[model samples]
Target: MLQDTIKAQLKGYLANLAHPVVLEASLDDSAPSREMHELLHEVAALSDKVQVSEQGVATRRPSFVIRRADATGQGMAGVTFAAIPMGHEFTSFVLALLQVAGHAPKFSDDVIAQIRALPGKYAFETYVALSCQNCPDVVQALNAMSVLNPNIHNTTIDGALFQDEVAARNIMSVPQVYLNGEPFETGRADVEQILAKLDADAPRRAAERLKDIAPFDMLIIGGGPAGASAAIYAARKGLRTGIVVERFGGQVMDTDGIENFISVKETDGPKLSAALEAHVRQYDVDVISSQRASELFPAAQPGGLHGVALESGAILHARTVILATGAHWRHLGVPGEEEYRNRGVAYCPHCDGPFYKGKRVAVAGGGNSGVEAAIDLAGIVAHVTLLQRGSHLKADKVLQDKLYSMPNVTVLTEALTTRIEGNGKNVTGLTYRGGDGADHHLDLEGVFVQIGLLPNTGWLKGTVRLTDFGEIVVNDHGATSIPGIFAAGDATTTPYKQIVIAIGDGAKAALSAFDYLIRVPATGEKHAAVLETAAK
Candidate 1:
C-alpha cells in the first residue's frame, strides 16, 4: 500500500487526467490478489477521474488494465501490469495511467506518428523485476505504444511474481520481451530500438530525417558523463552544439550504485544520467538519441566540418567533434560465453542477480567489479565461486575483507575462465585454468562476467590516433592526435575512469576546442600544427 505522503503525491499527479480512467481487475483468492485489490482501492479514492472495477476479467490474476472510461477495445488496447508496480516501476505505472487517460506522452511527434502507424498486431509481454533500474523505460515505452496504437498490446509482468512463467521460458534477465509468444529482445530498449525491430523502413526513415541537418559548431559523439558535460559547456559558450549517441547515458546507464560522485552523497546511474540530461536540455543542444556513430571523418580543412557517420547510414557534420563515446563491459571471449548469454550468462549482477536466488553461480575476474558482484550475489545466491586470473584479488582491502567475511562465497586466485559450459539451453557450469595450467570445471547455474570494460573506439580506427588497446590518445587539454577533434572519458587515454573524472575531462576538452576554434585561421590546413604546438 502507498504511504500517506506517496498517496498525496499520487493524488496530485492524478489530477492531471483529462479523461476518466478505469482500473479493471481480475482477482483470485491469493495474497497478491488481496494486495492488488487494496492498492486499487486506495488509488481509486485519490482521484475523482479514476475508479476501480472488478467487473471485467483480465487474462492474468492479481492484475489490472488501465483504460479510458469512454474508450472501447477497438480504440485502444489497455495496458496491463500483472503485479504491484512498486520500486523502480512505480513511475511506470503512474505514467501509464496518465497516458491512457488522454494525457499525451512526452515523445517527439515523429516517434508518436511511427507508433500510431505501426503495421501489424503485436502482443508484447515484458518480464521485469521491480528492482531493475532499466525495466521502467521498456515497460513505459511499450505501454505508451499500446496507448498510441490499438494494434499494439503491452503486458508488463513482474518476474518475481510470475516465477512459473519465467522458469518455463528460461528467462533469466530483466526486461526480457516477448512478441506474439516468441522471444523478441532482452535488456533495455527505447522506442526507436523497438520500432527498428518491428518496422522494416524505420531505419531508413530515421536516417532520412538527419540527411538535411545543418552543421554544428561542436558535435559530441556520445552521451555519457563526458559527452553531456561537453555539450553543456559548448552550448553555454554560445557555440552551436549537438550530440549523436545511441542513448544519453551509454555505460553509465548500466551502472548501479554511484556513491563516489563528489558533492552528491549517494545516487544511482539512471538518476544521475537523468540529472545530466536535464541540465543539457536547458541549453540549445541538439540531442539525436537511439543512433550510434559508426565512422568518424576528420575535417578536410581548418574551420571545415567533420563528418560523423551513423549506423543508420546517416552522416552528420560538425565544426569541432568531441569523442566521448564511452566504454562497455568486456566479455570473457571464452567458448560458450555468447552462446549462453542471457541463458544463464550475464554481465550485470545488480539486474540479474535475483533470478539466481538459491542457485550456484560463478563470478569471473578478481578486480573490484568481480569482488563486488560476488559480495552481492552471496546474499541471494546459494554459493558463489570467484575466479581471478591474477595471483591475488585487486579490489580494495575493505571490499576484500567484506567478500571474505561471506561464508557462501569462495575466491580462487590465478583462475582464468576458459569456457562456459551449457546444455544447449542453460548454463551448467564453467571451465577455468588454475595456477597449475590445468583446466577445471566449476558447476553453477549462472556466470557473471565482471572482468573489465573496453572503450567504444572500434569505429575510430584509421580515422584518428588510437593506442594499441583502441583508446583515443589525448594530452592534458583533451586534444587528440588530430586537430579540431578532441576525446575524453573511458574512450580516451585518461586514467582512472570515474564519473567525476569523465565530467572534468569533458569540460577540459570543450575549453580546448574553444581555444582552437578562436585561434585557428580559416585556411585549408595547419590545424594539426596548432595542436602539435599546444602539446609542446
Candidate 2:
C-alpha cells in the first residue's frame, strides 16, 4: 500500500512494452516481501507482455529478477535488484525494463565491443542510498554495461536494507561498487573508469609506468582549482609540471554551487572540475591522478630538487613542490551521523541543501560555515536550528547579527550533539546536551555539520614550517620556509579558503617558484648566473 502510487506510475510506463518482460520477486517471511509481491502484481495487471512470478528465497534477501519472457513464459536470469529500486534508482530500474524489451539506446561501437570482450563472468554489486544524486548515473552506466555483456551481471542493493554487508565492507559513502566480492570503487565514475577497474592488468601497468617518469620543473600536489591553475601557469611558461592528486578536483569536487567563480555564474562542482581538468589537459601538464602523497623531502640545497613519495611507492622529484592538497569537512562522529549520511545528514549545504527545501533542518556548528549555512537555509527551509558546542558562537559578529535577523533561525549555544536519531530510511531528529547537563531533542529532517576547516597538510608536518593547527605556514608569495617548497589553497595559512582565493594563491606560488629557480643557483652548479646574464 505504501508503494501504491509508484505501482500506478510503473503501470503507465509499462503500457507500451513491445516485447514480453518477466519479473520474479523472491519472497521470505519478511514484510518487505509482501509489499514487493503486491507491487509486482499491480504491475503485471497493466500489460499483457508483462508477467510476474515468485520464488521461495534467494541468495540475497528480498531480491527480484527481470528477464525477457519467451513464448512459453519461461525466462533466464538477466538483471537482479537485490533491494527495491526506489527514489533515484527507480528511474534506472524503469530504463532497464525498457532495455529488456528491445527499447535500449545504442552505444558507441567501441564501448559495445569492449563490454562484449570482457572475459569471464563478473558480478557487480552497487551499493546506493535513496537520496544520493550521483548514484543514479553510476547505476545507469552499470545497467548499460550489463546489457552489453551477458557475462557481466549487475545487482543494485539499497544500503539501508543490507546494514550488515555495508558495515562489513566499511562502506561510509554511497554509489560504491564491488566486483567479484572485492572493493572496486566509490562514488560516481565515467564508463572508462569502470572499464579500467574491471581490467586486471591495467593497474599494474599504470603503476609501473608512473614510476619511470623523470623529474619535473614544477610539481603541484593537488588537483583542485588551485592546482589546476598552477599547472596551467607553469606549463604555459614551458615548465615540465605534474599534478599529483588522489582525485582530480579536490574539495571542489564535492562542492555543488559555483555562483562565485568570476565571469561565469551558476555552475556546479562536477562541471567546473571537468572544465579545469580539460584546460590543464590542453597543455602538456602531466596529470597524475588517483595518487596520494604520503611523505615530503625538502631539497638539501636551492635548485637541487625536492622529493615526494606517494602511497603507491612511486617517488617523484620536482624542482619546486606546490602544496595544494585541500581540506575535507570535519564530520561529527556521533552515532547515526555516518549511518544516515546523504540520507538526512549532509556536510556541504550548497550541494544537498536544495533537497531539504520546506523541511526543518539543523546546523550543527556555530562557526562561520555553520552560521553561514543557517543563514542560507533559513530562506529555503521551513525552520533552522543552529547548535554550537562552545559557550559562544565562533562566527563573526556580522554573521551572528545576520543569523539573528532571520525569522526562521534559532541558535543554541553550549550544545553538544550526542546522537542523530533516524530510522533505517532517513534521519528523523537529533539529540543533544545543553550546558546545564540537560538533554534536548529537536525534530528535524536534515542536519548540516560545518564546524571548522582542517588543512590537508599532515604529510608536511616535519618537512616544512606548519602552524600549531597543522596548516602549512607561507608568506605572501606562497613560499614556505623551505626554498624549493611552496603551499597554497586550504592547506596553507591563507586567510580565506574560497576557490578564487586558492586560484590566486596558486598563481603566486608558481610565479614565486619560477623566480627562485631563475635567481638561485644549485649546489655545485652555476647555470643561474649565466642565464641571468643572457637575459640582460
Candidate 3:
C-alpha cells in the first residue's frame, strides 16, 4: 500500500519507538482487510520494535489498534484505526504508533494534564475522508488524548470506505466526531476546544492560568500567515512576542491547494500551517491556542500596554498589538440554509462533495472557489449548476475557461440565491432570481456556498478605525488608528487578501510597531492626538 520511499521514511520514524508496539488488527474476509493486512505486515518488517498480531480486542472489523505491548484493557481504551489512514491521515497514524510506543505527543503540558484528568469514560469515533485537510487535527487530537488517558478511546472511521455507516448515521461531512455513540461535533476542533467541551470548568481554569502570563512587548491576536510572520520578525528584534489565537491556522486550515506562495511550487493548507507553526516555534514566541479575543482595549497612555480580553474571561496586556485575525468563509444567509446545513447546504466542496455522488448539485458564486468546486463536481455528480451573483465570473481567466469547458456544468450570470429548498431531512433544490428578472429554481441534491470571506474584525469595532464592511482601517505601514495598534491580512484594509501579501504585510506591521515603540515616550499620554492623526 505504501511506496518504497514512504516505507523507508516510516522505517526511520519508527526507529524512535522506545518500546515494543503491537498492531492489533480485527479484520474480515474483504479486499480492504486483505490490503490492510499486507500493509501492517510490511510496516512490522520495517521496524524491529513493531509487530503485528490478530485476535486482539476489537468491536469493528477491518480495524486495528496501536497499543503498548503490555497494555491490559478493553477494545475501547486506546487508538483504533477503522480507516486505511493513508493520504492526509497517514501522519496521524504514524504519530499514533510512536505515541503508543512511549514517544511524546506535541501538546502543551496544560493540555496533557487536562487529558489525563478527564473524568469518566469517553469512546470517541471520528469519521473522516483521506482527502480531508481538516481531519488530521481532530483525529490526532483524539488519538493523543486516548493515549494519555486510559479511560478515553478513539476510533477513526473512513466515511468513504464505510458508506453503509455514513448513510445510516446521515454523516455528510468530514471530521464528524461522535462521543459514546452520539454526535459530539460535526467540524474541526483543536485540543483545547475538545477539552473545553468535555470539561465544563475548563474555561474557568484556563482563564486563571492565562492571568499569570506577563505582558509581552508584542502580542499577535491571530495565528495565520500574518500573525506567524509578525511573531517571527518581532522575536528576531529581541522583543517579547506572544500569539493568542482561537486556532493556530485560522481559515488557512480549511484551504487545500497553494501554488502561488512564491517559492514553494505546491503545498496544501495543513502542510503550510505546520511549516508556519514550526517556523514560529524556532523563536521565543509564546504561542497560545484556542483562546478567542472577545474585546480589544487600547493603550491607556502613549507607549502603555494594550489590553485584550479573551472569550475565556482572561485579559492579556501587551505593549503593542497586531490584529491579524484573518477571515472565514462567507455563508449564503438564505432561508433553510442553516436548517439543512449537513443535510444539503454545505460550504466545503472537498469535504461534503462525496456525499452527493451521481446527484445534481449547485455551486453558488462565480469566483475561484465556486468555479473550482463546479469543475470538481462535474466528474462525480450528474450535473453542476453554477450561479453567479454578478454579470460575469470574477474568477481568474484560467479557472473560468476550464469551468466553461466542462460538459456537465451550466453557468448562470446575475443569479441571486433566495432560499435553500429542503425536505426536512435533506436538501432538494435551490431558488434564485435569474438575470431576466424572473424567479428560477434548480432541482439539485446539494448546494455549495462559496462567495468570499468575511473579515474577523468584529471584536475590534469601536476600539480601532474600521471600514463600513468591518475591515480594520490601516495606513501603508500597517498601523491602525491607535499608535501602538496595527492590523494585517484579511482583517485589515489591504486590497488583496492573498497569503503572500499577508506575509509581507505582517512583516511591515511588525516593523512599524517596533518603530513606534522606540519613538514614543513611556509616559507620553497622547492617545487622543494619535487617534486624530490616524483618522487622516
**Top model by lDDT, which number?**
1
Minimal lDDT window, size 10, model 3: 525-534
RMSD of each: 4.1, 9.5, 3.6
Q: How close is candidate 3 to the true structure, as a TM-score?
A: 0.96
Q: How many backbone clashes does candidate 1 have?
A: 0
- The sequence of per-residue lDDT tens digits that candidate 3 reaches over residues 248-270 is 76788889898999989999888
Greater-lDDT candidate between 1 and 3: 1
How well does each candidate superpose onto the true structure, as a TM-score? 0.95, 0.65, 0.96
Clashing pairs in 1: none
- lDDT by residue (tens digit), candidate 1, 383-448: 999999999999999999999999999999999899999999999999999999898989899999
**Model 1: how far is 302 from its true place, Å?**
2.9
**Deviation from truth (RMSD, Å), model 2:** 9.5
Residue 246's lDDT in candidate 2: 69
Number of backbone clashes in candidate 3: 0
lDDT per residue for candidate 2 within 1-536, as digits (tens), equals: 43668767777888767688888778787877776777667667877888887862567768887887762322235568877776667788888887777675455465567677888887889988765656766787787787667777788987767778875775546677888898787777756567766776544555566766888889999998889889998998899899997666787776655788898879767667868888998999887766788888777678776778776557777888899998988888999998898678877665456567688999999987899899988987999999999999989899899999999999999999999998787889999999999999999999999987788888777779999988899999999999888988888899988889998988989988888877887553323332232234
Error of 2 at 360 (Å): 7.2
